[model samples]
Target: MQYRKFGKTGETVSALGFGCMRLPILNEKSENIDVKRAEEMLNYAYEHGVTYFDTAYVYHRPMHQGISKGFSENVLGNCFQGAKREKIFYATKLPTFVIQSPDEFEKTLHESLTSLKTDRIDFYLAHSLTKQTWDRMIQMGMLEFLQKAKESGKVRHLGFSFHDELPVFKEIVDSFDWEFAQIQYNYLDIRVQAGTEGLHYAASKNLGMVIMEPLRGGKLAVTPTEEVRNIWKKSQYDRSMAQRGLLFVWDDPAVSVVLSGMSTLDQVKENVRSADSAIAGTLSDFERSLYAEARKAYWNRTVVPCTGCEYCLPCPAGVNIPSNLNIVNELAMFGDVTLSKGNYEFQPPSERSENCVQCGVCLTKCPQHIQIPDHLQKLTEQMK
Candidate 1:
């Protein structure tokens, strides 16, 4: 396993961290985990050299009937129960997004401890902080609570995971003496939330950066269009689609760890192999050009380049403008007609793109001034 020092902590963490969100499920019919299978995967990952495990409060809730629920944290606790806890760094978040008052911070922290079956967390984050939550944290004395937890040995490191604009992200980064921070990053999302700018900003402050959705929620690995596949073939270096995507982030020294939510033993092995061979500065000029070309092709074919900034928000008719654009973009970029259609159709009729009342509220707010209502109508027509 390749190791990198975590910020200024003098602790070396694996370059490829194991995300516990998408562990293998045993049964097709229940939310209860197939413990035996999960154990095998976890043990395999540990043996192969992954040392970082990330989970959250709502990780295993039954989002759908066929999905396994309420087993991630407990299963992890059981899996690493008797081992030297220091050998592995376990990171989880305090669900501050759900808090209504100051007391709830302590309540959530204690609950996370109980659930993980650990005395002290190696890294703890103020989960999914937005502008609103950041304000609340100050009003509720969250920083004091974090300091107390650190002093009492309940948390080894304190930080946050972000999902808002760059300005807010920078504010949170500069707000505290943080050990590290997490952000959503990928090749296609460089200009989106936190983006490349945010990554460099965190590194400049000497904060360890953890990456989530490195694969864009598994979109990067699935079947590719002819144009994307052709671009990959042009590369002189041989690598899997997943490896190429991972290397893009790993190539940047600013990124500390790239998290992949692998569910199978094969995935674990493949990722480990990729990590072993993926050195900094591994991608040559030609390879970088190929990737850039492919990305350009993808953008040209499918997306409007909307960054989900919600600048065009507050649609008077309650239409989710950005989401509608994304569905259209995915359909055009990936050519996954079925997926695009299914996601659109599953939306409640009131929430569908067709529900737009064309009141122009979103148009006025749009930074891009996109004709959102017209785009939504066009998207619905194409998708249907």
Candidate 2:
């Protein structure tokens, strides 16, 4: 695997880090992970030089009674049992939304340390930080919590995973002396949350930039439209959409690592192979043009402007706004809506857009300023 110097840390992390949120699950419901199988996949990644592993406070979440969720960290503890723990860097996050008080900072950190069966976290992040959460954290004395974690020697590096507007991201980056940061970046998200501008700004500040959602939750890896496929097929390089996605992110010298939430062993292998060729500044002018053309093909077909940032979440009416919009986008992309309809139905009854109450609260929160309720009403009609 190719390695890059993690900015200001003097540590060279593998080009591909393992995002542990989407492990192979025990059932179609995706609540419980198949631990033994996941461990084998993770073990393969570790042996193959994926030195970074990331999880979160709410990943692999359990919703039902006795569903046995929160396996992300526990499974990592098991996967890195014994001397394996020293072989890689373990990264996890603080659940910023649920922190009622400043004291919960240490409380949650202690819980995470215990769950991972480790004394110190190699990298600890303020999970899913938005402007609202950052402001609340300031009021709750979060700076002290950050300082204490470092001074107490419990966390080696401090950073955040971001999901807000570019201005907000800039504010947070300037607010603290962070060692690294993770953001959603892909070919399709060049102008989305945080976008290319934010990526360059963070890199200019010398904070190690770790990329998440390189595949847009596996959407970019799927078969492209015939037009987009022809563009790739006509290109000199025989690269898959997924490879193009990974390569585009890695082409930027700002990107320190690209994290893929690999669910299957095949995904791990494919990503690892991609990592081998992921040299910074390697894409030629023609290749860069191909990515631009490919993105145009998607934009030509895309209906909604949503980037799935999920900032307008926990809808008072219980609608899954971002995901529902993604399904709706499939219609414009593929010229069919069956995938959208199926995906919309697959969402829990409470999370489906059909439950929208047209309250307009999401209007104030959405970065794109979407008329969310109005769109949901139209989508509900289309689905029906």
TM-score of each: 0.88, 0.89
Assess the local accuracy of residue 263 in candidate 2 as a C-alpha lDDT between 0 and 100.
89
What Cα-based lDDT does every candidate model obtain? 0.81, 0.86
Highest lDDT: give the candidate number: 2
Stretches of model 1 off by over 4 angstroms after superposition: 26-31, 64-70, 303-318, 338-384
Residues 129-197, model 2: lDDT tens digits = 988999999899887798789889898899999998899999999999998999999988898879999
- Candidate 1, poorest ten consecutive residues by summed lDDT: 61-70
Model 1, span 1-384: residue lDDT tens: 787777855577888988888877654422456778778877877888888888876576564433222557787888887674557888898777677788877877787788788999898988899898889888989999999999999999988999888999999998889989999998888888899999999988899989998887667877779989988988777777788888888888887888888877888888988888656677788888887888888888864767677887666787878888888888888887776786686465666798887787887888876778788888877865
Deviation (Å) of 37 in candidate 1: 2.8
Model 1, position 382: C-alpha lDDT score: 80
User: Count of backbone clashes for each model?
Assistant: 1, 0
